[model samples]
Target chain A: MFDINKRPEVIQLSHGGGGKEMNKLIKSLFFSAFNNPILNNDEDAARLHLNGDIAFTTDSFTVSPLFFAGGDIGKLAIAGTVNDLAMMGAKPEYLSCSFIIEEGFEVGKLKKVVDSMVNEMDKSGAKIVCGDTKVVPKGCADGLLINTSGIGRIQFDGVSVTNIKLGDVIIVSRDIGRHGAAILMERESLALETTLTSDCATLWPTVKHLIEAKLEIHAMRDATRGGVSAVLNEWAMGSNVGITVKESAIPVCDEVKGMCELYGFEPFDLANEGTFLIALPEDEAIKALDIMHEFGCEATAAIIGRVSEDRPGKVILKTPWGSRRYLDLPQGELLPRIC
Target chain B: MFDINKRPEVIQLSHGGGGKEMNKLIKSLFFSAFNNPILNNDEDAARLHLNGDIAFTTDSFTVSPLFFAGGDIGKLAIAGTVNDLAMMGAKPEYLSCSFIIEEGFEVGKLKKVVDSMVNEMDKSGAKIVCGDTKVVPKGCADGLLINTSGIGRIQFDGVSVTNIKLGDVIIVSRDIGRHGAAILMERESLALETTLTSDCATLWPTVKHLIEAKLEIHAMRDATRGGVSAVLNEWAMGSNVGITVKESAIPVCDEVKGMCELYGFEPFDLANEGTFLIALPEDEAIKALDIMHEFGCEATAAIIGRVSEDRPGKVILKTPWGSRRYLDLPQGELLPRIC
Candidate 1:
């Protein structure tokens, strides 16, 4: 039923049936893109050979517009899961990809999304070992939503929010808020001449490098939804320590700043994808920053803050003008589906 | 921001913002239902200590009319993933649940779904250790979709589709096609004064019994979408063998048979949730049937077929009247969102 030349331009309900058409579509598209012996086995579940401690995580990507400046939903799906593993100081291994596709969605578009997923997966060296596809009736769903659950081998121990200690330095991996700004711009149909794009990329490559270097990492987290403000606040509260962030060192590109100004949003309240925060000893901060620079994060990665014992469970942001304010955790909704 | 006295009747975008409101929703709802020390740790990813061969699988449930007969989407989501692990001869252990919910959805309904999930998970003893929740703007999604990814420890080996050898006995654990019929009746608003419900129950309890008994399980599969026909065809093709099913031996209740007849559907092509098929050696067929009987499948469980060497890669059905015909795989879409 899924003849290469005679396939439906738009997906039909039958394509999701656990029958011949579904088999053909899976074998021709998903299987080919995520080709692997474990996946090719075609069993009810994928058999995995795992040892030691493992990290388990799950996320569902329902980003609106599907296609964004630097990546599509598919790309976001893979990077998002892989990044979680990276933040846990784990080497991302097997991933399960599931998609809930809306009826009438174009097969061509689906192919493009799957391709983006494959390309993004290559950056993290993780393979999608098993997947499930379900098609909903028209008007029952909007476009497609992807869910990716990851299993990774823990490469190092003691990387946790609770591990942040006094004198531990906090580093912002790169410029923040691009993912949020890019999505807002695309939604508003801004035709600016500037080449702005979402900072969405797989972070495992850099995390792997840092792990191999053994720089004594305490905690790491991507500045995703609710941005750095949320991550900093949680660390301070969870670790029972205070954080002092030098406002000037927190990178915010001109594009993001402009969007924030135009939209009455704070840069700290924006979301990010590729950017991350690292917490380690003060002496190792320099080493971590150097490694980040070597990974092409130069001029962006900076020692932004430090952990303090004073005023536990608080985050203070010192402004460039010599003033300070409590960087409270984000409240209410800034933007939905900005991931 | 989350005042216990001022909770909104419906979910707001702030609930998924990764901030105070999101934290409150997670703590008040999800955390309380799937309460466990590992989940309460609140790390970016759940740290799990896993060893030996494991089974990893993922599924996204987008069943239309989130509440169905006998089970809601939440129960289905948990049972579906746990069943996949059970089929793989694995012990259901940990799961990561992610929700893509539409904005303005009822908070009360969400609680109901979550409660149903907890109840169903109790049957499998799998703990949900981590989860992600995303709220999409109204109209961007339909109701809610759940993605559950699971990791389980494999207990036995040699359980595969390709392992179905000649002289294997095929057995159906229970009456088939109830799930598909229930969904269809609901969609069509048929007031058939009959007690027809979706066969959506946690199958791990029954599967666990079989595994513990150590009866050779060549291959086992739950008859979900595309029904038993799909499973049979896949087994035939994958094992490079022939299967002959006796039409009279497959169990079907009176109500289900009536609904299928009215809808002009073949019961074998309809979906099921809790029902499953097992392929074992002919010598162990009686033992397997007895185990199923002890597990409360006595009236429904039946040895419906046998694997054969003739007509490799195909399935034949012997009718009650002694006629025989090829039981081809279900083709095209039988019913969208059957599961």
Candidate 2:
């Protein structure tokens, strides 16, 4: 008769104080959400296998409002770090979290955020090992900032951006910019009604599936800050190849598209927390799409474009109206603190 | 010829951008301040040998005002991380820095702060290994936050709090809480005319000398955020032992004492960025003090207290009138974000 689902939504200081409340929060939320062997062990640090090649990624979250419409800073922090590791075709195993908190910020709010982070990490099957906390005076900082660094084993041997070729097909994981749109909607006073939930979920399993399928994955990049346009532009520049995409093939949820239109924002340049741009050989594109779809990320998986040999280091979009336009790299951060 | 000594004091972002101004700042200020072989190499990451044992430490700086009365956030970040490794009797080696910058911050101010950090690392003989930079939107964060994590090798065996004993003598590195006083003075605008500088510096060399001299250093701790009183209380409680200290034997600079008196604060309860406490066997106390002094540390190191068996898990301070009073652990943060 615990009525566990009726738990408090706010965070508290004691949740981080390594006391009874901390234990309860970890057990009820984190362990339940991210039940894995390494995390379930409940050790200060996870013992990782050191034999394979390693991929390391670190990201810091300074999301305003701490908690947003669909997700909070805690979930974003874990998801962002895990996705960074996943983008490298690595199986994320361990993570280190550090918190910089402002004084007078509700302790209960922090607990809620931390609990959300734990749940996200559990869902992703990544263990939180080792953490440090520092408190600053009130008004000295925004409510809270979380820094997370993850280390994972690079299971694939020949995965590199250099492997990208002229005719490789580009496949997107899901709809774009849901996370950014949700955050913007929460921040502004626009009376927009839509079911635009944040696309904040772990992509490790999908990444693992693609790797296991023996698909010739040439390159992969997460559409985080600056969105798919930024990531595709970087890939084109890095690989010294040109890319062309069919604008109609790109998936955009109706709710997100409507929100972007209302806000005078382009979905292509907005941020996406859970989407990834994958480059693979044309022969393997269909099979890879099938594998990703099997992981319940089906609606938005599509062969949006292909690498080209004619023009180098440029991205072109074939518009829905039969006109070709060059997709330029993002000039500056579109939605700052989107991640 | 450039008058390097007359250069402006404010920091600039270009200093961290790996450009001409950054090089000049490094050579003029950092290289001139701390001349060391490893630091002068100027590689992207420092490469070193891991001979015997190792210890690691990391700390982040997000102080409200980048530049404080006595020291800036940059100096504090370097010293804080270095001291954590030193407290474990480890020889500090390589350090990694990551910056979370807020957009629209003045570039010149960031340069001065980075120059200070590089100088501190050079003085500490720790090399900059890896670094990362992420920019957040203006107003989403305070000016800048720096996260520095480092790896150090433990030079000696049996150097930990677990080795502490009932009758061991306690020795302090120097004055207790000048750093905290300077920060408070900057914030609260106390009209105390005192030239108090923060005691923030690298302590690895001093610790190394003690370990090399084969002094019986049972335990060591850097009295930082929670202050000397908090650290001592934790040590006593952790070891299930009692501690007794004579107030007269402790070192406190006249300026800091005056400031503390004016502010109605106890020097014992305030934080110290550079000071450390060592629990040593009574017989080896002098040799340990001698080694610390030879390393250019405060030469006025004193034996302030002794560990005791009676009244376990409690700390007492002996007053000038021969009365003993309980020194309870600090229940809350005294000076948040001191480091």
Candidate 3:
């Protein structure tokens, strides 16, 4: 077993190259984060059987400088698309990648990023079957931009925003804001960091486990760019229901909490790449938590709040200080390109 | 019916915006370029019932200066992905688009590009069922980058690269290098003018029509980034066969020929965004050309070459001057971001 803790916290262009360091990075981080049967095949493309309706999603990543703290653009590209499909309760099967590379960008660096993407796709149990590569003159583009589009089959029937109820319990998969905090800390070169890792990961297995465990999940969302507060606010507006989240029950990693305290940032507004907010019936909340925990996620699953009928299209947070504070969607990007 | 030639030669961003100009662009350009049942619906997505195996392909476009002289990035994005699926003899059904926009980009421009995509998808009989959007700070990216992924079904049984045979004739869908020449002329601001337009349009409908007409196509390839000469070289190497082509028989628009002469460039080395090369038995060559002609791509269709067993992994061109020359694959990009 490799020691993930001893690995480098910051990603470099070499991580995307198909070299020794690239292989190491994949085995230690991506393979460990998303271990599964189909993922272990390590083929150029994955073949699977679709038992039901199919859902597809695509996303592009153009994070500056290619790499960042906690995760690189490659990891974000995979996680973003996979999370989108997972939000729809789909079992991701195949992925197509296209790269627009700037001329003069280091080839070694590109190889690392591609290798990381391959490993991430493998671990996520998706195949990178078809791809196209185009090179533009230097300065015409950033160092690199990756576009990933994926196809996944719906794992269960009758899962959608329409199924959400007014009184359903809201469960958070794990701690919020770790990814945002880590990226900020790294960007500012702040001291006092104690192993603050980004929560960038593939969430399909956890979602699949929850489905198989027979939990009546009403709706699911990955609290990514907009964080928990923004996601909750959107859910309230979309479902036309009021939500009350207990601030104390929302999980926060110690490193993230310390960073937020030092930076005077609100944990609720911070982004999380891997964490998910699942709304389920009150009776099945506990089972959902157990199922997610068994998948080796951060597993600090908690019933952070519940849906309500009183104030439609509103999100209220029960603060630690016993004050009811309204949570609104972010007006602008707080940590641009953190994912 | 509108007179396509009388319409504007260069597409403005307005044509892609969802207004009158956009409607006119669609009716004149896209509807004229490709006409099919699936495309005629003009819905957000095209639905298909797969009777057999499926093949998927995708590509992204990030050309600088969104609008080009011959074709804009919008049309290129749609045509590129559609042609990829067509090369595999698949009937394209669905597409997912994701756009990354730089802040401060004109809203009118963005809408225009999107409208163009919708129109092109309609023309090609593909549906844009799902998509995503992200906004980045100004200067972080070019004006916009459009990524499109398409899914198509393999309607035929046992058609693949293995089907190629010696003595098969090579059929080009249209004239070569119009897109590459136009991009270069625009980028260099060459004073020379021509009636040549970019051959940037979807090809799946024509491929489908040819297949339905019972033309025995053995292998197909989109002569894109590296042009006809480069792609033919690759096919020769991949199939372990030799190719002999008559340079005089290879079609070239008069304007393109004049521009190449002025610029000291070879038309064979120039790129084409929308043309395809198909290999079939000599007996079926005329039938395939006839089917393509019925679809309005007849002007440039010609029997330029044939697969031969005299030499392996080589392409020989019989020049119009009665001199034999080796048509080597281009070493570098002739026109970057032509698509």
- Give the top-scoring candidate (TM-score): 1
Worst ten-residue run, lDDT, model 3 chain B? B42-51
lDDT of each: 0.91, 0.72, 0.71
**Judged by lDDT, which candidate is best?**
1
lDDT of 3 at A90: 76
| Tens digits of per-residue lDDT for model 3, B102-211 | 65566567657766777777766787666555555656667788888887776544344445579999988888988878887777777774666788888877887887
Task: Give the alpha carbon lDDT tens digit for every residue of A1-339 in model 3.
Answer: 888677434444334322234346445644444455444433212223343467677777766546666677788788778887788777777777777776666655766776677667765677666665565665666678888888877775545544568779998889899878878877777776378878888898888888788777778888876678767876787688999999999999888888888877788878787898888888887778888888957758788999989688889988899999888765433555454
Q: How big is the positional error of residue B319 in model 1, measured in Å on the Cα after superposition?
A: 1.4
DockQ (CA atoms), all models: 0.84, 0.17, 0.21
The candidate 2 chain B region of ten consecutive residues with least summed lDDT is B41-50
| Candidates 1 and 3 compared by DockQ, better number | 1
**Whole-structure CA lDDT of model 1:** 0.91
Which prediction has more favorable lDDT, 1 or 3? 1
**Best-fitting candidate, scored by DockQ:** 1
Distance from true location, Cα of B282 in model 2, Å: 3.2
Backbone clash pairs in model 3 (N, Cα, C under 3 Å; residues 3+ apart or in different chains), count: 11
List each model's interface RMSD. 0.9, 6.5, 8.0
TM-score of 1: 0.97
Candidate 2 Cα outliers beyond 4 Å, as residue runs: A1-53, A157-163, A189-191, A213-216, B1-58, B89-103, B124-140, B150-159, B189-193, B211-216
